[model samples]
Target: MPRFAANLSMMFNEVPFLDRFASARAAGFEGVEFLFPYEFPADELRKRLNGEGLTQALFNLPPGDWAKGERGMASLPGRQQEFRDSVKKALDYAATLNCRLLHCMAGLVPAEVSLTTATSVYAANLAWAAEQAVPAGVKLVIEPINHRDMPGYFLNTQAQGADIIAAIGSDRIGLQFDVYHVQVTEGDITKRMERYMPVIAHMQIADVPARNEPGTGEIGWSYVFHRMDELNYQGWVGCEYRPAGDTVAGLSWRERFAR
Candidate 1:
């Protein structure tokens, strides 16, 4: 069976960040993940986790100036220094939290930069990022975000993500397979999961067409869940979605899976 983690950034928006920890635990989540943790000190977040007896499953490296519309800096050329700085920062937090996985988002492909340049930079960045992550015992992950959801995103397909991981040639570098994004971009969820299971370190979920809790849209959640079990996906499956109603009330889907 797969372990489920509450995505504090998306699902538990009804409360303050600190309070979301307890809310997740109350809702029966054994682990949790969030978009970014730079706002509060790591110690404070740790206090909440220890209090709730929950584990920090995963989190992202800072996307450069998110408010300024930067998605991530990994693939952005001339930002190599900044990307390295971000990796060090991520390692610090991951070490402090004992979190073993970190998602590295590939930033938007700027119009002026050639795809060739961005590709080289992205591959080099991941190779370098892996050196730091491996020693820290943390795996660096790259997620294949869909173009429709993130219009200018550089990494947009499972094949592309797998290729990058293969090129980087490091066990420390892996894929953050978001089921919602993969279904939107590729449509072959089960096969892709099985095909990339060796390179996938973490996973996320949301129903298609709505990006809401499972079962709210077209995805056959039961099959997805059962398939992961059949494949023995021993990784965290993050609940990364918006709720259609009260957060707690939308948990029937999770309850059904927990059985």
Candidate 2:
């Protein structure tokens, strides 16, 4: 069976961030993930997880100045120091929370920066980050966000992420395969999943067209879940979608497909 994790960042908007832990537990989720935990102390987040008996599935490294539209600094030149500091801070939280996986976002590439330069910087930064993560017992992950959702986002395909993993050494870093992004950027989801399953450390899901719960969109969830089982993907499939209605009500898709 494929395990599901509630993405507290998107789901459960009915309550405060801290309170969503209980909401997730009440909703029958055994694991949880979020975009960022920097707003609260690591210990406080850990306490919530412990109180709810939920596993901390994953979170992202600090994105630079999200308010100013800075998604992440990994591919941006002259931001190596900031990126390194972000890595150190993330590892600290990972240690405190006993979480094993952290997603590294590849920020938007400026028009002035050529793809070759950005790719080179991204690879080099990931290499350094992976070296640091190894001793901490934390495996880093990189996600390929769709350009439609995050325009100019440096990473945009499973093949690209897998190549980076191969070059950086898969032991240190892996891929965060997000279903919605894959469907939007490129179809043939199952084939991509099968091709990259070996390097996929974590997975997330949302329906295409509207990014809602699975059954609300065009995806054949039954087959997707079944294919996951066939592929022997033993990782959390994060419910990272916006609820069209009540969050709890929309989760009925889980029973319908994940069984």
Q: Largest TM-score belongs to which candidate? A: 2
lDDT (tens digit, per residue) of candidate 1 on 1-259: 6799999998778998899999999999999999999999998988999999999999999899999899999999999999999999988999888899999999999999999999999989988999999988999999999989899899999899999888876486888899999999989899999999999889999999889999899988888999999988899999999999999999999667645
Candidate 1 at residue 218, lDDT? 92
Error at 106, model 2, angstroms:
0.7
Highest-lDDT candidate: 2
TM-score of 1: 0.98
**Alpha-carbon local distance difference test for all models:** 0.92, 0.94
Give one digit per residue, the lDDT tens place, for model 2 in 1-259. 6999999999999999999999999999999999999999999999999999999999999999999999999999989999999999999999999999999999999999999999999999999999999999999999999989899999999999999999988898999999999999998999999999999999999998899999999999899999999999999999899999999999999889888
- Model 2's alpha-carbon lDDT is 0.94
**Where does candidate 2 clash, by residue pair?**
none
Quote each prediction's TM-score.
0.98, 0.99
